[model samples]
Structure formats: C-alpha cells, structure tokens
Target: MEYFTELFFSGLTRGSIYALIALGYTMVYGIIGLINFAHGEIYMIGAFTSFVVATVLSIYGFPLLSIVLLAGLAAAVWSASYGYTVEKIAYRPLRHAPRLSALISAIGMSIFLQNYVLLAQSSEFQPFPELIPDFDFMEPFAHVVGSSDLVILLTTALVMVGLTMLIKFSRIGKAMRATSQDRTMAMLVGIDVNKVISVTFIIGSALAAIGGMLIASHIGQINFFIGFIAGIKAFTAAVLGGIGSIPGAVLGGFVLGLTESFATGYVSSDYEDVFAFTLLVLILIFKPAGLLGREAAEKV
Candidate 1:
C-alpha cells in the first residue's frame, strides 16, 4: 500500500507538469489546429529565464517564496514574448497554406530555437534553485508523500481552477472559444480572430513557461535538449485526452503520468518512455477522438 501510495504521488507530481504543458499544446491546436512544436523550446527558455531571475535575487538574500514568485513572473513574461514571436514568424503566415507547411514551419522553428538556446547558454545542463519547501506536515508519511509533491499538486490545482474560470467567465475567453470553433464565423461576429489567435499563443506560452520553471525547480536540473522529449510527451498527453479539450488535457496528463510511474516502479525505468508512447498509440487506435475529445464534423 505504501509503495502504491508513493507511486501515486510521484505520478501526480509529474502529471501536474505535463498538464500545464499539455494545456498549451491543446489550446493552440483548439484555436488554430496547428501544433506549435517550438512550444517545448519556449518552456526551456522559461526555465532558464527563471533561473537567471532567481540567481540574481538570491544574491540579495530575499525570502524563498518571494524568489520563487518573482522567478515565475519573469519566466512567464519573457517566454510569452517568444510565444508571440513564434506565432508571428513561424505560424501566422503559414496559416492559410497547406497544413503540412505549417507543421514544417513549426518543426523548423523548433530546431532553430533549440540551437539558438544552446548557443546562447552552454550546451551543458544548468541547475535550478530548489525553491519548493519540504513541508513538515507530511513527515510521518514521508515514505508515501512529501512536501515537494504536495506543493506540485496544489500548484497545479490552483492553475487549473484559475484557468478554467478565466476561460469560462471572461470576455476574452468567449472570443477564444468562438475563434476556435469556427475562425471565419468568429471574425464575422466581430471578434478579432488574429488577436484571439495571438492571445491564445501568449497564454499557452505562459502556461508552458510556468510548467518549465516549476518542473526544473523540482528536478533541480534542466538542459537545452529537455524540451524535445518533454514536448513530445506533452503532445502525446494532449492527444490522449482529446487535443482540443482543456479538461481532457488534464485528464490525459494524469493518466499518462500514472502509467509512467507504474511502469518504472513495477517494471524497468528504461521502458518508461516506451510504455507511455505505446499507451498513447493504443488509445489512438481504440478511440480516435481521445478519451474526452469530440469528433469534428467534416464538410465534404
């Protein structure tokens, strides 16, 4: 029981990070049907940005919590700028082209960004400051759960709730939804489709930035190449949950996380990625629309 309990928390912690990144993947796809492959690179940049911020703040001996919060803000804002630039340069012009063109552009941009970061920062792995506090409340059950895990879970919950509320109640949220469902019709109804798309990119990038910052802090290390693998897994999560569904993305994240955890715990760590990708393939084969995804209508 204790082993399973530990595994559960571990999976949830990982899933929380994946959920954040997957949300970014799903939002962009939902709004424009384009997979922003460069998004994972954006996440990498965010982690680096936060690291720079925290490092500078640490020299001043600020509170741990203040450093964490400020680091997150800096990461989000900085990465959001990259997101906007990505959309403007890589995706926006290709929007009207064949879908393949947009996909290739994304791939090209992903490569460009990866190399750009590698050159700017060292190719070596960078360590992140451990800002997450280890809570004493879980000391008795430290074998099963820890303060760090609790923080990850709570942070994810707060982000999910806040994002849901924003999408459900805000005027911008409605516009986003309208543009996602039907771009032409949304523009006809007076919504600025381009603005909505751009905002969507910004929001998605910010979410990815947060994920990158939080996960890097938790793991204590990051590198320019981490984004490639993480991006693939997040994209798989998006597909598993139904790419366009926000709730589905979260569900898929947890499901995929649990799958990886159990695989590593009960089986071999070497097979973790294999197991995750296999599960995604099975889900795709069995339910093409995804667990929570709706099938799109085709106008022949």
Candidate 2:
C-alpha cells in the first residue's frame, strides 16, 4: 500500500505537468486544426525564460517565493510573444493553403527554435535552482507525497478550475467555441476567428510556460532538447484523450503518467517508453476517436 501510494502521487505530479502541456496541444488543434509542432519549442523557451529570470533575481537576494512568481511572470510574457509571432509567421500564411504546408512550416519552425535555443543556451543540461523549498510538514507521509508534490497538485487544480470557468462563462470562450465548431459560421457571426485563434495561441503558450517551469523545478535539470521528447509524449496524450477535447487532454495526461509509473515500477524502467508507445498504438487501433473524443462524420 505504501509503494502504491508513492507511485500514485508521483504519477499524479507528472500527469499534472503533462496535462498542462497537453491542454496547449488540444487547444491549438481544436481551434485551428493544426498541430503546432513548435509548441514544444515554446515550452523550451519558457523554461529558459524561468532559468534566466530566476538566476538573475537570485543574484539580487530575492526570496524564493518572489523569485518563483516573478520568474513565472517573465516566462509567461516571453512565451506570449513567441506564441503570437509564431502564429503570424508560420501558421497564419498557410491558413488557406494545404494542411501539409502548415504542418511542414510548423516542423521547420520547431527545428529552427531547437537550434536557436541550443545556440543561445548551452547544448548541455543546466541546473534549475530550488524554486519550491522543501518542507518537513509531510515527513510523516514521505512515502506518499512531499510538499513539492502537494504544491504541484494544488497549482494544477487551480489552473484547471480557472480554465474551465473561463471557457464556460467568458465571452471570449464563447467565441472560441464557435470558431472551433465552424470557422465560417463564427466569422459570419462577427466573432473574429483570427483573433480567437491568436488568443488561443497566447493562452496555450502561457500554459506551456507554466508546465515547462513546473517540470524543470520538479526534475532539477533542464536542457534545450527536453522539449522534443516531452512534446512527443504530450502529443500522444492529446491523441489518447481525444485531440480536441480539453477534458480529454487532461485525462490522457493522467493516463499516460500512470501508465509510465506502473510500467516503471512493476515492469522495468527500461521499457517505460515502450509501454507508453504500445498503449498509444492500441488506443489508435481500437478507438481512433479517443477515450473522451467524439466521433466525426464528414460528408463527401
């Protein structure tokens, strides 16, 4: 039972990060029907943003809490700019063109950003400072969770609740839903689909920043290349939960995290990736619509 509790909490922490990243994937795909392959790069940019900001702030002797908040703010701002610019440069031009063109452009941008980061930062891993200081309050239940993991869970819960409220009650949320349902109709209704799409990118990028920073803090090390593998896994999570469904993305993230955790614990750590990929394949084959995804019917 103790071992199970350990793995469960660990999986939940990882899943929270994955879900945060996965939401960006689902939102972009839902609104634009384009997979922003460069999104992972945006996440990488966010981590770098946090690293630089936190390091600089540390030099001035700021408290850990202030440093973490300000660093997150800086990362959010930087990633927002990247998101807006990427949409304009890489995706906006190909909106009316073939999907393949947009996909290719996204891939090109991904590679470009990856190299750009490698050049700007180091090609090697960088240590992430302790953003969330350890606490002994959870010492009694160390096997189940710790203070850091609790913070992660609380942060994820708050973000999700806020997002749900924004999507369900806000006017922009209404426009977003309309645009995702039917762009032509949304534009006809004066929703400004393009603006909606841009906002989606901005919000998604900010969310990605949060995920990146959280994961960086959790792992204590980061590099330019972490985004590539993380992006691939998040993409799989999006697909597994149904690409266009926000709730589905979250569900998929938890599922993937739990799957990997159990695989590592019961099976072998070496086969963790194999188990995840195998599950993806099986889900694709058995239920292509995804667990929470609605089946689409197209007319010829």
Candidate 3:
C-alpha cells in the first residue's frame, strides 16, 4: 500500500509538470491553430533564466523565498518575451500561408533556439539549486512524497484554478475565445485578433516557464537538450487529451504522467518513453480527436 501510494504521488507530481507545459501547447493551438513547436525551447530558456537568477541571488546571500520568487519572475518575463518574439518573427508571417509553411517555420525556430542555447551555455547538464525548502508540515509524509513534490502539486492546482477563472470571466479571456472560434469574424467584430494571439502566447509561455523552474528545482539538474524531451512529452500530453482543449491538456498530462510513473515502478524505466508513445498511438487509433477533443469538419 505504501509503495502504491508513493507511485501515485510521484505520478501526480510528474503529471503536474507535464500539464503546465501542455497548457502552453494547447493555448497556442487553440488561439492560432498553430502548434508552437519552439515552446519547449521557451521552457528551456525559462529554466536557464531561473538558474542564473537563483544562483546569483544565492551568492549574494538573498533569502530562499526571495530567490525563488525573483527567479520565477525573471524566468516568466524572459520566456514570455521569447514567445512573443517567436510568434511575430516565425509564426505571424506565415499565418495566412499554408499550414505546412508555419509548421516548418516552427520547427526551424525550435532548432535555432536549441542550437543557440547549446552554443551560449554548455551542452552538459547544470546542477539546479534547491530553491524549494523542506516544509515542516510535510515531514510526516516524507516517505511517500517530498516537499518539492508537494509544492509542485499545490502550485499546479492553484495555477489551473487561476487560469480557469481568467478564461471564463476575464475580458481578455472572452477575446481569446472569440479569436479562437473565428479569427476572421473576431477581426471583423472589432477585436484585435493579433493582440489576442500575442497575449495567448505570453500567458502560455509564462506558464511553461514556471513549470520549467519548478521541475528543474525538483530534479536537481538541467541542460539545453532538456526541453526537447520534456516538450515532446508535454506535446504528447496535449494531443492525448485534446490538442485545442484546455481541460483536455490537463487531463492528458495527468494520465500520461501516471502511466509513465507506474510503468517505471512496476515495469521498467527503460521503456518509459516507449510506453508513453505507445499509449499516444493507441489513443490516436481509437479516438482520432483525442480523449476530450471533438471532431470538426473542414471545408475543402
């Protein structure tokens, strides 16, 4: 029972991280119908930003709480900037062009960012500082879950709730929904479609940044290539749930995380990726639209 509980919590923690990144993918796709493939690189940038900020702060004798907050803020700000720029430079131009063009651009951007980071920073993994402190209250459940895992789960839940409220009642949220439903009609109705898309990218990028920092802190190491694998998994999670559906992304993230966790615990860690991809393939085969995604008819 203890082992089972441990695996459950572990899976939940991993899922929370995946969901955070997956939200970025889903939001971008929902708003612009373009999969921002470079989003993973945005996440990697966030982690690097946080790492730099936190390390400098620590050296300067800053308090733990202050370092965490500042690092997260810096990560979000920088990541958001990169996301907005990517949209304008790589995606915006190809908006009206064939979807293939936009997709290729996205891929190129992803490759560019990855190589840029590799050249700027070492290709080797860097140790991430333990920004999250051990909580006294969590001592009792220490065997089943660590303080970082608890923090990740709680933080993810709060983020999800806040995002839900933003999308449901906020004015910008309404604009986003309008834009997603019909970009042409949204522009015709006086909505700034471009601004809405930019905002979506900003929000999604910020969320991914936060996720990157948290997971890096949890896992204790990071590298330029970390984003590639993490991004692929999160993208899989987004597709698994329903690419354009917010709730679906969250659901898919948790499901994928749990599957990986249980597979590692009972089966073999060597086949973790294999299981995740196999599950995605099976889901796609059975329900092409995804678990919560609805099929749409397009005019030819």
- Per-residue alpha-carbon lDDT of candidate 3 for residues 1-300, written as tens digits (9 for 90 to 100): 999889999999999999999999999999888988999999999999999999999999999999999999999999999999999999998999999999999999999999999999998999999999989999999988999999999999999999999999999999999998889999999999999999999999999999999999999999999899899999999999989999999999999999999999999999988999899999999999889987878769
Alpha-carbon RMSD, each predicted model: 1.1, 1.0, 1.0
lDDT: which candidate is best? 3
TM-score of each: 0.97, 0.98, 0.98
Candidate 2 lands at a TM-score of 0.98
Candidate 2: residue pairs that collide:
none
In angstroms, the error of model 3 at 237 is: 0.1
What's the true lDDT of residue 212 in model 1?
Answer: 90
Judged by whole-model lDDT over C-alpha atoms, candidate 3 comes out at 0.95
Give the per-residue Cα lDDT of candidate 2 at 48.
90
Worst lDDT run of 10 residues, candidate 2, spans 138-147
Deviation in Å, model 2, residue 266 alpha carbon: 0.7
lDDT of 2 by residue, 141-168 (tens): 7667877788888888888888889999
lDDT of 3 at 187: 96
Residues 93-173 of candidate 1: C-alpha lDDT, one tens digit per residue: 998999999999999999999999999998998878897877777788777877777888898899899889989999999
